[model samples]
Target: MFSGGGSHACFRDCVEGVAMTCTYNFTITASTAMSYLCGDCPNNVSACSNPSCIAAGGIVRPVTVVNNRIPGPGIQVN
Candidate 1:
């Protein structure tokens, strides 16, 4: 999930917004350093326009994980 369109723009604006899967376990006593910022989806490629980038060794955009879980038991169930 890479999104940063403030300077010029090359390839970093593919956001579906909403995804965290859940799975954390970090215990090291102390001494941390975590940072992540990517919020700029005015259009976000026309709201996710088909562009998975078939192949090329790299380039498979599509990331938006950050859910902490709360609506379990099959939400909506549809």
Candidate 2:
């Protein structure tokens, strides 16, 4: 599933000899905001900043690669 923001999905022409037109749509729910929320360390320690750190007894914090970003990267038919 995509993020709250919008994403661009392209349908490229394939050598299979088929049409390359595509269309897609979806709804963004309120939870989208929570999805990217950054949680801080338990004691506000800088060491434990993200969830990844918490795995090692660090902290629990939500992190977003790019705030307000959606769809992530891209896909090529090559």
Candidate 3:
């Protein structure tokens, strides 16, 4: 089974029946955004425009992500 959301848990028991092969294709590209909440913050708000707002508050910079996800997608097999 294949799942997305950047979870690290195993999903072996989530699927039933015979085992099958799963293939996934991803494209990497350069992207820019106003802000990306990398971690916990006050009231879940962020000021990416501020240069000082790094890490938890996120920053306005070039980022490379998988399938347009920050933590990338998750893959599971059984």
Query: Whose lDDT is greatest here?
Result: 3
Q: After the best TM-score superposition of candidate 3, give how far the Cα of residue 63 lies from its true spot, in angstroms.
A: 0.5
Question: Which segments of candidate 1 are over 4 A away from where they belong?
Answer: 1-14, 30-78
- Per-candidate TM-score against the hidden true structure: 0.14, 0.27, 0.46
Q: Each model's C-alpha lDDT?
A: 0.26, 0.38, 0.49
* RMSD for each of the candidates: 18.9, 9.3, 7.5
Q: What is the lDDT, from 0 to 100, of the residue 10 in candidate 1?
A: 31
Worst 10 residues of 3 by lDDT: 48-57
What TM-score would candidate 3 get against the native? 0.46
Per-residue lDDT tens digits for candidate 3, residues 14-40, read 456656555576766566534443333
Q: Provide the lowest-lDDT 10-residue window in model 2.
A: 28-37
- Candidate 1: give the clashing pairs: 19-65, 19-66, 20-65, 20-66
What TM-score quantifies how close candidate 1 is to the native fold? 0.14
Better of 1 and 3 by lDDT: 3
Better of 2 and 3 by lDDT: 3
